[model samples]
Target: MPIEHAMNTISERHRADILIIGGGAAGLLAALAARRKARERSIVDSDFRIVVLERNARPGAKIRISGGGKCNVTHDGAVGEMLVQGFFRKSEQRFLRPALYAFTNDDLRRMLRKRSVPTAVRDDGKVFPVSGRACDVLAAIEAELRDASVDVVTGTRVRSCLRQNGVFCIHTKMSDFFSSRLVLATGGVSYRHTGTTGDGLHIAASFGHDLVPSSPSLAPFFLRHPVAAALSGVALRDVQLSFRTPSETVSRKGDVLLTHKGLSGPACFSLSRDAADLMRRESGGEALVNFFPDFSAEDMQEMLLRHASAHGKQLIRKFLQLQSAIPSGMIPLVLKQAAIEGDIGWGSLTKNARCRLQRTLQSFSFGEVKAIPLDAGEVSAGGIALGQVNAKTMESRICRDLFLCGEILDYAGEVGGFNLQAAFSTGWLAGSSSASGSAGTGV
Candidate 1:
């Protein structure tokens, strides 16, 4: 399957029992779940039509490129753990709970497994197809669509969504559609290249939903520190990164990659949302990188003292190189930042110098950090507020028969497989609930 697009010609007018906007992960899963629910109610025999309107030429553009083309499908963990991760706001968690519990990560893997897509979970619990090909995952979903008779409309950007006389009319460049139930899974304003250009936000707002004010969620931070620029390509494993704002401090731990511009990788991306959000409010924020997060400054100082007592004649640089996990290339930078002479022997090291070295090794600072942009993130945060949507069904309280889910909602997860799982879960709920209703007609 070489990224097949629905290159079929658009129809002038279409009618469906359920019309789902966006053919991304959420939309596709919603369609599947909707049809499943419809069949269980004997609604399929009634000539029920389900359509997925995709703006791009093909479906799952983001999925094809996610996890470096491997597609981290979901995080492997207990459902309780995933819920307590604080990915969604406390108020919004109530709304997300039902969908997440209803369709767990194991459920997702089981669905893929049935389609011949074997998955493996990493040590950190991130799940990806063993084939390491995102297309396989997409192909599996596409197969399900074909099996369920989902009418996928591609290369058709939706122009407007309006409800009149209890029927939702969706206008697209390709055609116009009328349906009793309409689902907005158009995703958030990130990855514009993948066709997620914040279209869902405006559509949801038009239906009387309030937005949460969007920003980049799992993005990298641009450091103003010159050393970080020079240390580009240096990777630190299990490092802890903490950001300090005037109001509060937030931190995350994972592998960090020093990029030419700033910091990236799991640790940085996990904390990027808070950093970016803080920067938006005001300035004067700093990131403290705990080189040895497990060790306290006092602990390091005591260890160094014992080492100095044993190898008093050795050079400070050599002593650190031998006793610590800090890389050889990082030693010079650390010594310089600590204002300690690199050539100084451990025996000659003063008490003041010992404390300084311990502090530097414990917490190195990136003076000021600025995030790239919301679009640079894997998923955009903020969308239709959770208060207006039903958690059990994903249906809109403001408007009848209109549903919203995925990144189009205010919930944004961290850099694991959390975001994708959220999308799939919400989409399933929305689609199932949307299709379970009686088919309505226009005025």
Candidate 2:
């Protein structure tokens, strides 16, 4: 959507006690929490009004597309387990503990149940709606907004935000809105089509908040080798992915998909953020796949030697097909990589040739990774610096009456439902804290 200066010149002004920018999962939760907190402190029924401003035509675009439209609501686990399992930094895990404890995954399930959206936890610990529709999850939030009487403005992109005399004037393409308390849950730079284009980061930076440089997370890597491209669409279970850089090497084991460009899947995603960071600083790095993760090099050599002895008279190609657990299509590729002739007989195979075959089967190199596109990622790392925002309240330490939540902060989690859980917990804290602070002391 293009910003129109002419429209802003004649745009009408609306006022509210609390203003939330963005109508994503975090924004929706904040709006509800703020309303609830305000009512709790108020002596009168209509004490303060809360409003949500969304740039998109509708809210929760990200939610509707999450988990392949099923909407993984959150991960099912204890707070400590979630923090450690998803590979979140120790410092960030500690910072998020209060919010995670305050609004547990059980609390979220209960809240959704009250909204008529029953949820089920998957075997892998991912929580999803029983209906298997992300729209239902979004509908629940919309219902809460209506019940709380929160004003929602859609199709209005914020042009600028100015703070003067303790009031924030948010200028949009359609109009100008005023409020003392402002909550920014606009998300990160990824998924620009969903209205998370790093606007909040830019606006926050303009207001004197330092920004950590943004990069893509949870995205497939593009490799320098043609092997991944040739094996596109082939999937392997129980494989280990190793990312090797000059400084360090990281490995993860899970299911992986070979794409036209490179690698993707849960295992690859676990290494994406660190891979992106390394690829950004250095031009490239090596990615090696342990196709036979269950067996060591010595174990593989022993197994291969036994199989060769049993099928000494057979062709090497036929012997590998009959004795190996690898996929039929992958065997030819592996043989080619090992520089072994498929037509060669097992009886004629030399000791050195057999050793080469065993090593290649154990670990296949995918060459170097070239790049990871920032926009193609599921989440974007780097946003508002963590130190500038209070993890307890999600309020800005540098500015008054301002709260930050969701991907706008410099934190990213591994794929699954960790990111969504973080959004909900942080949003809950920011909303209630903003309302209580405004009503008691008046920011």
Candidate 3:
């Protein structure tokens, strides 16, 4: 359908029983879940209308661009496994327990499967559609919504939202909407081009909900000293990245990709939140990289000593490249940091040089980090404070009949389908609770 026609369809219908703002993952699922719940309760479609308002020309803009367009629907695991592997903080784990269990990854896959969108899980446990197209995932969701008789309004930007005499009023560029219940799923400020501009945050705050200060999470660093062009695309597996703050040292271990600007991949992204937070208070900081995260300093030293004694005639650079698994392009930089000559024979290595090399191998400095761009993050940290919303139902404690879900909440999970799962889980809970008109105890 044309964008103009979609907008026009909603113009005449300004009232809904459940109004959802932002047609991304959360909004789409919320609408569908509400309709499903309503049907299960024997509520007629005429008695309960669900409407979704989206700022973009179509819904699921972020969904279409996620996972390089393949769309990592959700991680492949049980609720407990996902909670343990995907979320780090205990608070987030506890708060998300009910919702995640209520709507598990299996449930999401089953829904897609029913829509004829078969999914496959990668070796690393990231699940994607078998066709490897993000549009297929979005199409499945759209199909479900259409079958449920849910109304979706696209290209309509919400100007403001407020509650008046128990009814929620939402003003948009196209028209005004009123609803008894509203779901705020506008997502975060990250990926502004995809229409997530933190509109929901403002709306939530206006209704007396507290907000956690927003920051960039799952973003790459911009180094003070950029990687060499030759080493730009080089990648390392099982590396540990650490950043030092005044209080303590934060670390993460995973695969890393050396970009032309600085560092990316799972390791860098995992530590980016801490790096970004630290850099926000301090001007800049350095990230230390341990290429051999599995080996201790003593283990590496013993191995290198044994190798040097056995291969006395071999050049240090050649030994590092062949045995240590260090990239050829990085040898020069590594040697320079250790203050050792790359061409020097292993037998000619002095005690001081060997020690320096060992230390460098254990904790090689990546570089001074200038900043972690907030806009470049896959998901932004912080949102409406978790305490302000009920964990079981995703309803706002401060505002009756107003529910919150998705990136609008203060929980930001790690990459590899965690964020999307949280969105889906929370949206499902919010939709079900709101449709049933049940109030949840705020935890």
Candidate 4:
């Protein structure tokens, strides 16, 4: 309950060496890093002041809500995935490499260990904080800030910033503050209710930063099939998700969930970014997706032909008896859609019927992806263009003393744990770079 009531402080002005806006993962990390580097600095000292402003009552609220309420702090994979061939830009990915590898999943666990936060590693190598409590994640961050004596002011809504002389002046609903360097980690517009209301974009845009258009990522899909609606709650492990774009066909296998609306879970979350992008490009038009990708059309055809040849002496069910795990209810629909009549016995199945079944198994085309509701998303795809900022310092190229990180930057990833990793990495860079040798004297 760190969230304070909306009470204005009404102070004329405050001063700091580093000012960090937004206390989510990135902001908190920035404040902590500055304090560590500043060392023994007074909050009131003009030489070393570090302040963190958060609009929410408490920091890390979004981090608290991730992974079905189990905050996924970071991933165990190599840091290489953050850029270029890995998924993000080279500079943005490089910014994270230092802290990501420096701290690592083991380090996060060791820090959370004292709080009795248990951690577990999934088969894919994604690590959870182990406590299964978002508060543990928040507590770990809050503890760092408190230990460093970093000034954390909650419920402070920023209006704008003015750069005068070499310092930037910050105006907020609560009061005014000045800092030599400013970090904008206000995040993006994915979870509006959590206070990520695109506030940073306005402030950064006001300062002339090049921004890439943003759209919701890792969002759910909406389907037109009656069978989809019927199997809404069904979930399948080891299932594959294949996307068909005009130029290429991409497929990934993992866990897949059947939502009341359509498909989701790991497979869907992985494809969500590109799906939303293409879906928007088509202007509400549909995209084709396949639920089963491991078996090829040829493989399905061969299996069906062999089954009918031998089981032709048995009932339809007898033909599929070897694969009874597939729900009996879906068998008829799958066969019918493939143009294989329901009444035919396995022995009577013709070569033409087998080919149709091959099509169904190899490519069960699902309809277009519907509009993704912003609040339902985990992250957004676009943000401050990577080329416009100094990756080493996260300093804005257009606005001196201004830094951008977190979702405000174009570094995002899949559902498991990459988002938090981006937050920690960028926050660390902004903080250390802002506090390093010459930027500011005060903490």
- lDDT tens string, model 4, 245-340? 565554667666777777778777777777666656655534333434556666666766776676677666545444533455456656666776
Badly placed stretches (over 4 Å) of model 4 are 1-13, 40-47, 81-95, 98-103, 114-118, 224-229, 245-250, 284-292, 317-329, 441-443
Which regions of candidate 1 deviate over 4 angstroms? 1-13, 85-89, 226-230, 440-443
- For every model shown, what is its TM-score relative to the native structure? 0.92, 0.92, 0.94, 0.87
Output the number of the TM-score-best candidate: 3
- Candidate 4 Cα deviation (angstroms), residue 315: 4.0
Give the Cα-based TM-score of candidate 1 against the true structure.
Answer: 0.92
What is model 3's C-alpha RMSD?
4.6
lDDT of 1 by residue, 34-80 (tens): 88988988775347888999988999898899998989989988876
**Preferred candidate (lDDT higher): 1 or 4:** 1
**Model 1: lDDT to the true structure:** 0.83
Worst 10 residues of 1 by lDDT: 1-10
Worst 10-residue lDDT window for candidate 3 reads 1-10
Indicate whether candidate 1 or candidate 2 has the larger TM-score: 1
Candidate 4 overall lDDT versus native: 0.70
- The segments of candidate 2 whose C-alpha lies over 4 angstroms from its true place after superposition are 1-13, 43-45, 225-230, 314-325, 440-443
